[model samples]
Target: MFTGLIDKLKGKRTAAVKTPEIMGLRLGASFELDPLAIRLILDELTIESCSPTQIIRAAGLVELDGTWVYRFYTDDDAWLQVVAEGGQTDEHVVDVKLFHFYDTLDVAGQQAWDRLLQREIGAASYSLRERTYGRVWTSAGDYHNPVHMAEKTYDGDGEHSLTDQFTMLFERPLSDQRTESLFLSAEEKQEQAGYLSRSLVISTGITLTPSQLTIHG
Candidate 1:
């Protein structure tokens, strides 16, 4: 009976772990490792043992058959969706969606954004270009929305926009310049694009759980 219980527990373990090191890489802007910094963050994270189903449910990584879906809430009240399939080795295998909280914006600003969308003024197939971060769509493109939000006042009371509000709430920085030009040394634009593609995937979201071992046929 003891052996059987151990087998069950082993079976309950999933193949993924969510540690601060992984989270830092996932949510962090840069892909390059700062070994010391990563070590420090990892040391601070509280480690625990839990079943795969529990961990997945807690982290919002739901599994349906062979497909896994994860959702992450960004600093701007925008939610990002990531869907992954089993055995997929490519970064492009992950599907990303940005859900903006439009209701958070004021009437005038919302209208301004609506007009831009109506005209198809800044819609792009991809949320972020090879060189930008956050929702890249909008009238101003890339980081413009956040910057605009910072400059706007609520009821002319010198208050920041909803974007700014969330940023402060989440303690996420407005900008991370360390990895801004990580791909600059690449010999070609294609190389730079490839690097950015991978970096974006790595910096999308973070998890704070332990890794699990699983057996596969």
Candidate 2:
């Protein structure tokens, strides 16, 4: 199945697959598109074939710099995008991003997502916002990783006190402009808020192993 997921979708999954009832961050566990193949990630996994079997047309979207981004069409609710550099839709991809935005999910579906990520990446390494911006990072422990972990709660509202958000940046890389913002722009720092990043980053790769973790539904 997908990476190791036995999950399946009912409709023809487009670049834009139907949004699940699950949250975006939680979907990370359920998603597994091969880094070498620049095509439709999985929408459904047949018993016989588990890899991506669909090809899609590029949307010709560009972002960050001149980097070309290709976004697929999912249902109106959930959105997944593939952004690559130099307009090269071929496999020479340096940056890859998959996003899951779904309708509020049932508990079973929701837990499915959480358990998968908790098993893969240790946990969301950091958090932010007066009202919980909930950024999940794909990092083993570092927050700069492309993924931002979602928060359990969103009461980031400075009800206790007005607060400022601190963001860490990692110079320049694949998709976004992270590091330049804070280093070139920070004019002040707070003295009291407690912020110690697990500063942890975890990385795991897939292979042709019999012990891969599989999620079945």
Worst 10 residues of 2 by lDDT: 179-188
Q: Given candidate 1, what's the lDDT at residue 132? A: 41
RMSD of each: 18.8, 19.5
Residue 21's lDDT within candidate 2 is 20
- Candidate 1 local lDDT, residue 81: 40
Q: Model 2: residues >4 Å from true position, as ranges?
A: 1-60, 102-217
Model 1, backbone clash pairs (residues 3+ apart or across chains), number: 1
Q: What is the TM-score of each predicted model, taking all chains together? A: 0.23, 0.24
What value does the lDDT take at residue 34 in candidate 1? 28
Model 1, position 19, has a per-residue lDDT of: 17
TM-score of 1: 0.23
Candidate 2 residue-wise lDDT, 1-217, digit = tens: 6733433354433354322121121122233345332222122211112333222211223244645443332222222344456645445345433322211222234455444334422323222111112222345453232323221111112112221212222221112222111110111123256632222221111111112222221
> How much is the lDDT of residue 47 in candidate 2?
14
On lDDT, the leading prediction is 1
